[model samples]
Target: MTTPSRYVRSKTAALITFPFSGGQPRKGVELGPEALLRAELPKQLEQLGWGVQLDRSIDWDSINNLLTSDADINSLKNPRSVSKASEELANAIEKHARAGELPITLGGDHSLGTGSMIGLNRVYPDVATIWVDAHADINTAKTTPSGNLHGCPVSFALGLDGSYVEPFKSWLPNPPIASPNRVVFIGLRDVDEGERKILKEQNIKVFSMHHIDKYGIGKVVEMALDYINNGTSRRDRPIHLSFDVDALDPSVAPSTGTPVRGGLSFREGHYICEAIHETGSVVGMDLVEVNPLLESEAAAQTIAVGCSLIRSTLGKLSRLISGETLLD
Candidate 1:
């Protein structure tokens, strides 16, 4: 029998449900965590022999604060509320990581990435990130056309120029900085103009759809691992996989905040997670942007795929079925 890898350092996992939606202009995205939980995500993880610590008592009232469109950054919507939610999430994630448990964040939206990564980074300073998404999500407040905080998490986490908002900057001033060089992006097809310039200027590594089409998913992943690990064994470096369900083609994951055409295939999406799991270095993961109310017919499909992706990253499929024999 094959032994399970050491992805969860403490043999325990903390499931942090970030049921928040202040990052974007959407209401239904906040329902993602509940939908995923109702789908038996905690039980599924426990089936993989993990000691799951699920957070059932989420104080939405305490975490949320009143906000208006008026902030230091005028175009940025709900700036104070988004910052508050992110700060709270960061503290929760940090608590789990400090205890040596892997953090599995069921995100309310992509905006939660700011807090998730920040919290994980606090524990592991050298953490490498694999940002899997249809959009680069690196836009700053000034560059974001829609002023949605979801589109600007990457900037906030990286301490980019335009992310210095009032409330976010006050508390998360010295964010655990993940060097731009150590981060890699995959499945990006709809990056904004300013984000494109920032990507080039900062030399952030990216494997867009065109690159994926050329190199294939396997080679692309290999390249991503090599780049982030700096040619060291991937197992030696801590990994943070921030997976947005919209990274997959809308046909595969139709219920999301932003559905882009011509995205990663279902297999491609799973392949990314599976490869990362094989390294046994995934310290933190966030599955975000799953809007169950978007596509009625495809809601179940999207939720199932999201759950399966989580399973894939947690070393679920690395084992064979019971009573299976290898004909050697």
Candidate 2:
């Protein structure tokens, strides 16, 4: 039995997997959640003393049923099904939050952010999110050139679709999880022309590669943490970290569904997570778009190491020796 404490307590971390591949044009991102598990992520976290709850499978059949009903020529994949799965995911995350447990979701794709963010919002209501990725995922169905749902999750979360009817409407009744001012994007480099316009007009805080190059990652992370944690004296709202694996340099994490050039170095990525851990307000996190099929054996090993770095974000590390400091 675990008891809650003041600063820290025995925490529960759930590894929730949704194997839906329809979000992206690519097929293998659905394998991401399982691939992380096969790499022994649970055991690693267990070594850090978190009580691990593994929701190995979600009902993809239920998602299929909803999608089939809402299928369209323009929207080839089922919006109804995707929304349904998101709702279920939301419910699960809400349950974990209410229990005072930390939830760490694995990727089915970036589209799953729709569900994960919704779930976090339901629990914390005033929650803020940190979006770390190579591209700005803010395209609507009309705006998306590829018609891939993965590219449109941020738009969906923000409720920006022109065809806001039926199943799609149920996904997000409100417009966006956090206000544009509240959200911060880091490590962006490969944005579409329209997305660049949307990001600029909305005044969303974007720390692009150029910004990082000028300001340094340490300063960028400091600004992000302060922005999210500001003005909360008593009970701070939760912070949801949506980390697209593609935010990392392709050389470091090449197994993603979309590999972009010029992303965060391995140390930079780990430092972001480590700094978030320092804040102690992170409630939920998602590591998305890791496509093992696109990887070689060496690439898979690299991703597995990267996943370990995420564990560090949740305060997972080897037990300290008697004389060793945490900083050591």
Candidate 3:
């Protein structure tokens, strides 16, 4: 019998349902977890030989109550709410990840990336991260045009320019969780001007749609993994995939808030998860920004894809395609 890898069990996914949308201006992203659950995402993973544990210890009401003040600190909306909840989320994810369980956090927004990575990095300090989104989501307080906290998670995780402020500064650690070298971004097409400058200055790795059109999904994902591992074997490091549904073209996942036109096809999106599962080093993942309040057919389509992608990450796609056995 093969032993399970160190990073995760053939482990249970501690399904953390974050019914939060305070990170941005949207109202329905907080409904993401319920939509995925109603679609039976947990049962689907069980069929793939993974256990599912719903994390109910988090008091989401209290977390939301903290947002009563509409005051923006340093131009960041819902500052206290996002900061306090993220700190709580960090604790929750750290508990599961440290126990060697894969924490598949259903996000309220990409801002949860700030908390999720902090949790995963606390366990695997050298963890590598792959961010799949239409926007770089790296704008700091100074660079953000809309002042949404969701757009600023990446900078907060890296301690980049304009991220050093209260609330975040109080809990977000020194030296931050993500080192610039260990991060990579894919499916980016809507990146802002300020964000482009940071990507250049920080020398981050990015595989935009232009690159994907040039090199194909397989090669782009391969290059992303190679770059994150610094050209070493990927098995030695832990990985966290933060996927925003907007990375899929609007047609593929039309229910998302920031749908982009040119995005990954269904096969291409699933293929990325397959590649990550093949590494067997994924410790945590986040599926964020799914709003089920949109068109009925479109919402259903987006939810189905979200469920499918989550299963792929848990090794279902690889088990089928490569004839690799999963679980005992």
Candidate 4:
């Protein structure tokens, strides 16, 4: 018999759900992925002529339970379980990327970044990550006061120590997925004191609200693009974008578990996503930490619309129709 084709056509986008919510002290983020899906995200993309493949069978609950049981009572909520869930998520995302599909991940929480980045790194060793959030998320276990793993994913993904125990070593890779230079943080306003030291010490590029205020979104994005795309030999180095809903102002997305004030405006957030899409190298993305329980149904609907708008920045609903701009 003839061998089956090794490469399936990748015209469809893969929606991978990660529903674990143990990253922070809250419990509602576990429902984020499902809520976004129910918001008719697939139909929206379908309207733009892209096929949608929903992969929602992830065992987020089991992962959450495992982490909660193994967690240190005082330090963090669920360290081991978060790491375990990340490992599983990494495997799935890696599989999809290797198959040449665009992997769009729905987060259980921001900690999912550890697993998601690991998976992307396995497929594209030289990949870079663009972290869009209100907090730096670079704090390690030694620096974190809240013990929220969500604030430590960047550290963990870079192989820095956090709340993880000895038994969870295998869940994280040795060198992690990204280097300090390869990662860029944008839209930050609320930064912990320890996180500030680590960021300055590592010389990690951070464009905080002050920077945005000085340079404007367009200029900031231009600088960010240059920073992330600099010195790469390959024409297309794989890009993984980690988007926390809290990156937007609480006025825009109040349903996030950790809403920070003085964040990016809706247009600013969309501009970031659009600029990244313009790079033509984005292969994976994550929408994280949206909590429906924190808001009314109407508010959740608004947040859902914002999610759709962000997805559009990735060309989710964009079409190549003939049109003239106002300038034209």
Which candidate ranks first by lDDT, i.e. highest?
3
Clashing pairs in 2: 66-81, 67-81, 158-176
User: What TM-score would each prediction reach against the true structure?
Assistant: 0.92, 0.88, 0.95, 0.89
The all-Cα superposition gives candidate 2 an RMSD in Å to the true structure of 3.4
**Residue 300 in model 1: lDDT:** 88
In order, the Cα lDDT scores of the candidates are 0.83, 0.73, 0.86, 0.75
lDDT tens readout by residue for model 3, 175-226: 6665656689999999999999999999999999999999999999988888
Of models 3 and 4, which has the larger TM-score? 3
| Clash totals for all candidate models | 0, 3, 0, 2
Ranking by lDDT: 3, 1, 4, 2
Candidate 2 lDDT over residue span 1-328, tens digit each: 2322222243878778877777766777778888888888887777666689887556777776656565554753556666677777888887777777777788878888877877888777777778999988887777777766777777777666453545667657555554744678899999988788777777678889888888999998877766666633332545788898889898888787778898899888887877677666677888888887774774585558557666767664323332222422
Per residue, candidate 1 scores C-alpha lDDT tens digits across 237-316 of 78899999999999999999889999999999999998998887888999998888886778888999999898888776
Task: Indicate the residue-level lDDT of 320 in model 4.
Answer: 33
In candidate 3, which residue ranges exceed 4 Å CA deviation? 1-5, 322-328
lDDT, residue 61, candidate 3: 80
- How many steric clashes does model 4 contain? 2
Q: Which stretches of candidate 2 lie over 4 Å from their true place?
A: 1-10, 64-70, 73-76, 161-165, 230-237, 317-328
* lDDT of candidate 3 at residue 45, scale 0 to 100: 78
Model 4: weakest 10-residue lDDT segment is 319-328
